[model samples]
Target: MGKALDNVYKHQSLAYKYFLYLISVALIVFFFPKGGKFKYEFQKGKPWQYENLYAPIDFSIKKSQEEIAQEQLSIRNSKTDYYTFDGSIVTTVKNDVQKGLEQWFATNTFTARQQRDALKIGMDVIDNIYSLGVFENHPGSNSIIVVRNNEAVPVAPSDFLDLESAKRRVSAELSHSAIENRIGLESVIQTSLRINLFYDEALTESALEQELSRISYTRGEVSQGRLIIAKGEVVEAENFKILNSLKEEYESELWRGNNYYYIILGYTILVALVLIMLFLFLKRYRNEIFKNNNKVTFIFFNILLMVLATTLMVKNNESYVYGVPLCILPLVLKNFFDARLGLFVHVLTVLILGFVVPNSFEYIFLQTIAGIVTILTASELYKRANLFISVGQITLIYIIGYFAFHAIHEGNLENIEWILFGVFVLNGLLTLFAQPLIYMFEKLFGLISDVSLLELSDTNSKLLKELSDKAPGTFHHSLQVANLAEAAANEIGANAMLVRVGALYHDVGKMEKPTFFTENQVTNVNPHDDLPPRESAKIIIDHVIQGIEIARRNNLPDRIIDFIRTHHGTTLVYYFYKKQQEMEAEVDENDFRYPGPIPFSKETAILMMSDAVEAASKSLKNPTFLVIDEFVEKIVKGQMQANQFLNANITLKEIEMVKKVLKQKLTNIYHLRVEYPE
Candidate 1:
């Protein structure tokens, strides 16, 4: 068990650990909630009640009881007693009938008391008319009609047809109607006073005129509370205005606050926070792998790409459609990491991003399947120029994924055609255009990109040119080392470009003192030939530090500089150390070693192994494929046993694969073969 655990740790690298940490951060942010819930309710009534003044009321009156006992019962069955009067007289006659009539006329006609009593009665009639349903009540105005001697007179609204006005109008009506007995015609005349009753509210002049034209019974004239008529009669207006007013009141009540304003604001904040959290987590995770250089710009580009995808997803989510083409990301990762780890992480990222997007389960499943296919297809195939072939290959995977997804879901084939066509276009775009798009985005936003691996392939890089000019043999050796490193990285499904780049610059310090390095010794004379073995060891050991300084001075990337500094792995300078021991010289083993923290990352580890293997293989006089195989296996195994690759993420199986690939590459570089009979 201990051995097994040790083996596991042996294969782990810092790069891999940082990669996992990034994923963990993404998971943490995706689940954070940003909004709280609240209960909502709507009320049904106004805060205040209004009185309805136009309610219906009966206006009929009944006969009085004294009339029925008098024996001359003419009128009956009135709803009100005041509506009828009895017809009998109890007074005795005078000796001359004309003299008696003259005397009765003198007693009642034109007298101050009699006129006052008549005017009082007219005013009472006007008040009663207003109380009847004929007149409607307005909140601020009341209506009345004026009459004088049974005739309605024209008057201004301000002129109340008070008792005086009523008497004048009634007397004028009586003169016009020519009624002989005032008492006998009182009931008939009062009926005339009730001529045309309508809404008796005091309206504006124009409104009053308009309303007056609509009434057909009596001519309406303006008075204190009513219209005066030529005849003393009133009619009631129909009531419905109360309900109309009530409906208007209710409508106003309903137009109060909607509460949706607060709801919208709350929802906006919640959605924004959730989206921001998602972006923050993803950006942080990417930063763990990419470090902080150009971080915001890289994050901006990724977010823009994600936003575009999210927009498409939202537009098509309802249709169960997703538009991200094949597993281009997995190919990218595999081109950048171990095939197995790349596949696992790519699938995870796809699943998580699917949730972030508004896509259905079908999209998630299809993307996973397509991503697996692309990664598997490109796993161990690491020719940088051939990266595009993986795109076409992924396109085929996309077609299969799209059709299979729709077919399983029982979607209509005809409707699926447009989506399939769109998928094709998206595939072409992601494959052929992703790099250019990333490059453009980098320029626009000042982003640094991981997409352009081939830039590391520049043979005319400053360090390479420096090596070529100062130490031609070392330059040639660096090229061979690059070939071996690239092959090993390809075999393990790692970044061949990164490995190749590192290999090309690893021994750059040897250029500073070309004679001290065996590879650059052109005159068959070694600088160590004159120097003591300990001094020669110190020179070799210092070269790693010198290389690092030179690399930093030129502002090379950390990735390239790391390879230059760590490619030696603190191993003892065996030749120099052994010679010192033969001379019985006491020296510290550390003093005869190259100073190194070891190859801490997969790219650096691969660089160191390939450099050692390629340089050591050159000593064989008659190198064969088997000889090259043994040499590579020995170099890799020695490094593994010495714990040089202890913390690196390169797995045991991957190490074996690297060894096999290195052997093949070295055989090719050396043209190793058995000389056959010909």
Candidate 2:
């Protein structure tokens, strides 16, 4: 009945898993921009691979973006207008002339003849004033000019005068020039005249901008069937401009028709192919990851996260797309898995983004090179300096790539966008914070990383510190095992850091009753002498079980807790079982054996061997290099003959290498040698 229920559930689970995959892939592809890539990708200096390129539709050949921008600037600078003010103050000066004539009669300061002359000159100066507005030297103009009802009116530099100039001009132009200069009639005319014209700056700006909008953008026409370029022809600046115009017009018209749905379908298939390849890779090389639904979900979740963020940026504008942290994907992946997996996922992500972003060729080339560099440099980021160095290299790679692509498009650095260099700098600075992001993923995804291992390996950590205080002897033994395992793992090309950390915490179960284990029994008295062999074996076997419990309570990662449960295989406690065999004719061997699931990886298996060898090496009374070597060989050989490593994913040659590393380390710890005199 149980088997039948499990079979039914297994079929249902498979259907459910595949259903979720379909939904995830479908949702992502649905939101993708509906378009297909051109049949060929070409560069400015590169030769065209396809047959003669012809314009299929009647489209105008657009000017280069740089050329368009410069033309726009020229138009704005050319039509800039100046402020104009009409001479309405001339009418007020006429009224003031009557007041001045009356005031001259009342004051009696000037003679009747002088008053008549001053009034006549002041009246003439006010009437002769032209409707002119004066301004300082303006840019892109020989003289200050103002727009009047859509016509430009130029003002000579000396046309409108200052108070001193106005006084001198009014006095000099008088009918009695000699008598007017002596009488000083300049003050009377200067006071009556005023600056009636004023410059209106804001109004002029609006008129200039309106004039700039009238310029046309198209350079020329490319009628249908016109050959733009032939096969094997180098795409020069003019050819590139026409090709881009064709590409833009083609995309704009194609996406509006029913065929776009089919384009979406093609994109869906392509994206699905990449994701399915990643899944199959995990199933083959890292089946443990494939089996865990949570891990599979986390990997897909990151891809979705990057895709969503990148799409949002691209949707807003192409310039803002640079701010999206592309390297964060590979940095996060490399922290959790190996470099190959990181690079694989990064390439898939960039390929999908290529369809959404502008300039597909440059985007793909830049991101691919950056992803490769990130994978190669991002190792051992536990040290803070390594993180800085890696981020620096990734940022440098992005800057260099942008320069190379820019040079290809413009044929020189003449049209380089310095803002893009700034954008790459911003991208690099954002990448430096990936260390904190790795910590965030650990909390959010329930994942463990080497950064976590380095933290757990600290002797000052709570668990390790407690072990040292309570079970000094066992603590010492665990330390020696860690040293041996680390060296062995390094020799055999396994995760040396993981095995070392595992060895340190593997014996933490002995902390529950430190005095019961022989390593912690400082007094010569044995605690197990009071109990039966079976009961003593039960206590010994309980450590592996209890160790797992302790590790879990401490919130250590499951990857670490696994080492505690698998260090001891289902093997007998030899000394206690042998003593029972001497007293009883039939001693049940199972009662004296450890309840065990053997090590399941190279690092775990190395830990088991290191633990046994380090503990046994303490029993040699007169240890020499030869004795230690033979002793190490005997213990490792015994475990192999008993099939303790049946499940560990390691080979005979690797085990021999591990054995050699163990002997070398143990001999150094115990074997005595004469010190050389300095």
Candidate 3:
């Protein structure tokens, strides 16, 4: 048991990698829909590509969403409007009209017979208005169903009297009356009339909903063994509907009982395969990232994020699936890593999403093309304008790709969904968040990107300004080395920005004792002359060590610190060491050497070569092109022989390229112009 535990502890990293793979696969598969996938692909106005298909079992042909919506709308338009008739209101209005007419007659000098006739006429008008059913307001329907005495009866809207119509009726009836002061009697009747018909919103809505529910979502049925479509047949409107119904039914019925577990297993295997491909890709091509668990986690986490987002969108509403900023994946990865890895991971993510999204072929094609555009166009993420243009281009590609697919499916440009264009534009805008997200990832995962590198490369920064003030000559030397290193890195297709930033801070340790170095010696008094050779060597070698401490104090990223540690790479301080050897019989070499882990990447290796050649080129007297060439070649070749770049992932060919860049840059610095003879 102890041996087993020890073995587990020894291989913990390997076990952790497998655990990441397992968890990623589990999460992706868990989010995937449990429905079985249909084997056949079909589209309206396109030829069926598969063999002849027949119904395997009896299934009802379900109506399309458009058809169902049309049916529901028709039901709404043809629904019966319901209104409740208040008989009690009519009786109350009659009594109020009688009392109003009697009071008016009492106030004026009217004969008893005249008062009796006026009260009878006013009550008659009120009764007539109420019989026609005075409405509170127009119901906005030509016909209505009136509920009275617990029975609903059809009634014409014209039969109901609104306030204006009721007033008109009262005026017309009073004008024919023989009673004196007919206008007074008419006013009393109008004042007493009230609305007796009220719209029943609840009843109307319930009735409409009932009618809509009765709509037949399934128009017909296809029997078992019926031929649905033949190979190479054009999928017309009817054929497309039938095929979709069959697909829906088949997928829904396929995953039942034990088949559910099999579907889950199938999903697991496919997810595992895709993840395995990603792992193999990292292991083979991006071994550095594969070795680092944090980097691996970052990559997988991005994939999982996109998958979760896409699955949620599809589940809630598939129409808005394009609104998700999937292209952000490649953009973020390219900024943090390289374009190749970014594009590769983007393709794998889109492919995984294709398994769940509708129209797998079109989805995969559109996303894959968008990923390519993201990688190809997005450069210098630190620059806001570059990212904006790339996102615009990416959005335009989505629009065009979707347009083309739409045109193909419908066989024309008509009926194209214009809302999806807005979604694509929104997608582009969301992609701009990749910059901030990259900053967050850097903080969370302890990684660096070009954006941060650009910030670090600024000479006006606090640390860099301090370095320039304290060690002006060393700062200028670092500038020259930066230019040379940047040019070399660009020529060899390495990270030029990273190398330039590293070059800027490589000699920051010299700021501690600036005058001890010759470049900072303004006068001919050498400070090293007063100190012993061994002590001088110690001072010189301590710069690399001091730079690291200073960097840590300033919170510089580890990537930048790597350059400071490896710039000297254990090379001996030859001037001090040789002087000591002449004085003593023997001297220890280790005391004169700089502590180093050496350069381990292309950027660090370029900085080492650039630093050594730029510092040495200062010693040349009246240099020419040939002298500079031999000088640069000798320095780089010596470093190569001493195995300065043995651990770095660099080649001899690249080393020669770096030497050439140094020679040319030095020549240019000294103004080596060609002479034209007359």
Candidate 4:
């Protein structure tokens, strides 16, 4: 039991990594839609690639979205408009007419016969206008449905009378009348005429909506066991619709009861496999990052962020999926890591997204290609112009690739969605945010990127300026080391900017006692000469520790501090050690050694080589090309023999290449031309 506990404690980091992988998988799978994926892949105007297919079960053939929209629009345009006939108004107007006629008759001096005739004419006109139904306003449609007696009756516009038409009718009626007081009768009839018909907005909208709802989403049905399509059959528009209907029905039914768990299991397995592949990639090629749980978490978190963003966009609206800026993943990863890893992670992310986004093939193709373009073009992310150009190129690829796919699917550019171009442009614009995001990640995750390295490499920065002020000699030495290391890094295809920044600050601890270092010693003052060999060695070695304190105080990133820690590795201070050895029979080697975890990265390893060679080169007298080459070889080869580079991931060939760059640079510095054989 104790052994088991010990084993668990020893491998806790490994266990934690597994837990992270599981959690990432769970979170990704959870965000994925719970629907089962359709089994077959088909596209309009393309030949079906699968085996012969038949309808497994009966399902209504769903209409295309465009077809449904067209049907709805037609219903809205041609549907019957509803109007309410206010019968109460007709009754009130008629009563008012009768009373007005009585009052007029009482005031008039006409005979009772004339008054009766006028009243009859006035009532007749009112009846005529009300019979046709007076409208308050003209209906938009030529025909309207008037609701009367709790029943809708279709009426034509000409069949109804507005106030103007009602007046005209009243005038005609009175003119034909033999009443002596024709003008007075006309006035009474006109006053009695009131609009009883009104447009029923609520009823009209409700009726139109009902008609629209009645539109059949499914145009027809396919029976079970019907041969849908044979292998190599062209998936035309009609066939595409039927296939889509089957896909929807199949997936919907597949997600129903016991199958739901199975679907989730399937998704979990897929997502787990993808994440595992990423894990394997990091473990194989980027084991240092894999060991560092924080970096591992940062990578996984970025992937999750992109996936979550894309999933939300897809759920909100599939049409905006392109606007999610998936290529930003590659850009950010490339800035923090390398292009190969960035492209690999981007491809894995896109594959995971394929399970959720529409048009899996098209989406994967476009995004994978865009990621490649981003890695290829966005090489110099520190430069804003380069990033802008890269984003433009990525956008252009998206547009062209999408256009090609669209053209292939539809067999014409006529049906291409031009709005997606705007979406692509939006995607490009959002990709520009990768720089700020990289900066934020650097702060949050305690990671370093090229942009930060670029900022750090500036000589005028606060810490570097202080480095120059107090330890001008050491600062100049650092500059030489930086130039040498940067050239070596570029030759070896390592991170040149990172190595340059590391070289620039590698000896910052020398500032604490600058004169102790030979490069900073001036006026023939030898501080070390006054002390014992052991004390002198301690002072020299203390510089690394002091530099780390200074860097920490100034808030330098751990990555830069790595250079201060590992520039000398654990190699002994040979000068002080030899001096003490001459006096004593034996001396403790640890007392004269720099406390170091050693260079554990290519950049740090290159800095160690560059720092050693540049400092040693200053001791050379009348340096020549061959002499400088031999000197560089001795220094680097001595360090190699001491196993200083064992922890770094650099190869012997790369080391040789770095040596070549260092030798060439030293030769140029000394202005030494190649020797000629006479």
Best by TM-score: 3
Candidate 4 to native Cα RMSD, angstroms = 2.8
Better of 2 and 3 by lDDT: 3
Q: Tens digit of lDDT per residue, candidate 2, span 500-534?
A: 89999999999988888988998889989998887
> What is the descending TM-score order?
3, 4, 2, 1
- Model 3 regions lying over 4 Å from their true place: 1-10, 107-114, 174-181, 530-532, 583-587, 673-678
**Judged by lDDT against the true structure, how good is candidate 1?**
0.55
Candidate achieving higher TM-score, 2 or 4? 4
Candidate 1: deviation at residue 551, Å? 2.8
In model 4, which range of ten residues has the least summed lDDT? 115-124
TM-score of each: 0.48, 0.86, 0.95, 0.92
Off by more than 4 A, model 1: 1-335, 338-359, 373-433, 437-453, 487-495, 529-533, 581-585, 601-606, 617-641, 649-678
Better of 1 and 2 by lDDT: 2
How much lDDT does candidate 2 score? Answer: 0.79
lDDT of 4 by residue, 308-420 (tens): 99999987898899999898899988888889999999999999999999889999999999999999989888888999999999999998998798888888889678898
Q: Going through the candidates in order, what is the number of backbone clashes in each?
A: 36, 0, 0, 1
Candidate 1 per-residue lDDT over residues 120-192, each given as its tens digit: 4444444443322121122123333333334443333454333334434545554543324655334323333
* Per-residue lDDT of 189 in model 3: 81
Q: Score each candidate by Cα lDDT.
A: 0.55, 0.79, 0.90, 0.89
Tell me the alpha-carbon RMSD of every candidate: 25.3, 4.2, 2.2, 2.8
